[model samples]
Target: MKLYPIEAGNFKLDGGAMFGVVPKSIWNRTNPADANNMIDLTARCLLIENGDRLILIDTGMGTKQSEKFFSYYYQWGDHSLDRSLKKYGFHRDDITDVFMTHLHFDHCGGSVQWNKDRTGYEPAFKNAIFWTNEAHWEWATKPNEREKASFLTENLLPMKESGQLRFITRNENNFIEKSELDFGILFVDGHTDKQMLPHITYQNKTLVFVADLLPTAGHIPLPYVMGYDTRPLLTLSEKAQFLETAVKNDYYLFMEHDAHNQICTLQTTEKGVRLKEIHTFDHLFD
Candidate 1:
């Protein structure tokens, strides 16, 4: 089995929102904010190649939103989903499974795109099965008022409409009942309801796709949870348990939203579990 890091694109979000109630004085040190108080973020996806299956975990927010809609997020960067796929001698059609960690726009927007006529939406990966859990599918489709803005209909629905959507009826631990995908899934609810963090065993190491649960290295601390989460207090407890497990199991965290660092390791520190080292995807196995 082999893994590749796919660069989707970069965007910015209010540092305050990203850091939640954490003081700017603290988080700004690791994730420095710009003059506008916006912090850099990336929609970094993972491509897994195990035998005949080429599974993609999370497609970054696609380029379908209007300029006005994008202006709010401060979209910036030259990286794109299609170009990134080409970098690895792959194409969207090569993807047999598109595993979504969650249905947030930044994470799954690339699942659909405009048809040739631009009359309606279509599945971005024409031949791939879009994978998401039943609980999250319902949560995103009938989004609550707080998360409605992030759950756009265009980013969803089309995959289901295209008859390519498949639901993973997971256990309480979020493991796919009959998962064919070659990875262990750790179900987390701190960031969102039933966010499946893929635990890929590669080269004698477990590389976990740390989705919004730990957006960046700066979020290693237990208190540095995102305000976008519906249950902040629950996030604290979940993070603590996850971090402990990560440290105990010697897992390599594949950060999905960290712009500068692609992967990180945690070390037990006096304060708490802190970042031990940072590595690029190429250097992870080396």
Candidate 2:
């Protein structure tokens, strides 16, 4: 199997919001913030090639939102979803499966696009079966006030409308459970409800698609949680448990929102879990 680090684009978010309850004096050391307290983050998605399936993990924020909506995030960079796929000798239609970690705009917005005439929305990858949990699909479709802003209807509904939406409902422990193609999972609910973290076994190594659970290296600590999460206290418990597991397993965390580092492994220190190594995707196997 081959894996590709697809760059979608870069955007900024309030550092304080990203690092909830954590003091700026601590998080700012690694994730430096601007005068407005926003920090640049990368919308780094992953693509996997196994057997006849060409699967994409998540698409970054698409370019369909209005300028006023996008101005809030301060979008920047040229790495688009289509451009990244073309670089890998493929196109959007070539994707056989799209495994969205959740329905957040930054993670799933690129899955749908506005039609040419602006008449309606359409699945970005028309031929692919978009994968999301049934519970998550419902939660996003009728999102709460706190999350409604992040779950735009245009970014969703298109997959179902196009008859390409499917849910992975094999079992509850989809996290520790092994997927059909020998892939593993780590289901985390701290960041959101049931965010599946795919653990791909490659060349005697494990590459974990860490969604918002541990967004960036700076979020390695148990306390560095995001304010966007509905359950912050639960987040702390979940993070502590996973950090130990990631350290014991020497798992390579594929960060979705870190701008500088692509992947890293954790080491169990006397204080707690700290970053052991920061390396690129190819470097891990090279």
Candidate 3:
């Protein structure tokens, strides 16, 4: 199996929001904030080429939002979903599965795109089966007040409308067999309901996609949970357990939001599991 780090571009969010109760003095050291206190974060997606299946995890914040909407997040950088795919000698049509960790806009927005003629929205990946959990699907569809803004209809609806939406919950093992991208699914609810993290074993390394549970290398310390998480305390417990497991297994965490650091290894220290080293995806294959 081959793994590709797909860059869907970069955007900025309030640093405080990204790092829950953590003080600016702490996170600012890692991802230095701009004048407005917004920190640049990469919407780094992952692509897995296993046998006949090509799976993409998380689509990044799509480009279909209104100008006013984009004015808020400020999506910048030359990297994009299309360009990154082409960089790997592939295109949208080449994708067979889109495994969404969750339906949050930044994570899954790129799944659908607006038509060129502006008639309506369409699936960005034409031939791909969009994978998400049934419970999260229901929650996103009927979102609560706090999350309603993040779960936009334009970012969703079309997948199901296109008859390509499939729930990942039908499997007893919590994975699809034919989706030979064999990986253990680590589900965490503190950030969002049933958010799945792919614990992937590839090329002699055990890698875990550290979704919002661990957004950046700065989030290594257990208390660095994000304010956006629905339940902050639950996140604390999840992080403690996951960090322990990651260190115990000597796993390489594939960070999604961190712009500079792509992968990191956990180490056991007197304080407990802490950030051991930061490296890029290419460094791993090399």
Instruction: Name the candidate that leads on TM-score.
Output: 1
Candidate 3 regions exceeding 4 Å error are 170-181
- Give the Cα lDDT of each candidate: 0.91, 0.88, 0.88
TM-score of 3: 0.95
Error of 3 at 241 (Å): 0.5
**Candidate 1 vs candidate 3: which has greater TM-score?**
1
Q: Report residue 64 deviation for candidate 1 (angstroms).
A: 1.0
TM-score each candidate. 0.97, 0.97, 0.95
Error of 3 at 62 (Å): 1.2
lDDT winner among the candidates?
Answer: 1
Of models 1 and 2, which has the larger TM-score? 1
Give one digit per residue, the lDDT tens place, for model 2 in 21-66.
Answer: 9999999999999998999898999999988999999999988889
By descending lDDT, how would the candidates be arranged?
Answer: 1, 3, 2
Worst 10 residues of 3 by lDDT: 172-181
The sequence of per-residue lDDT tens digits that candidate 1 reaches over residues 249-274 is: 99999999999999999999999999
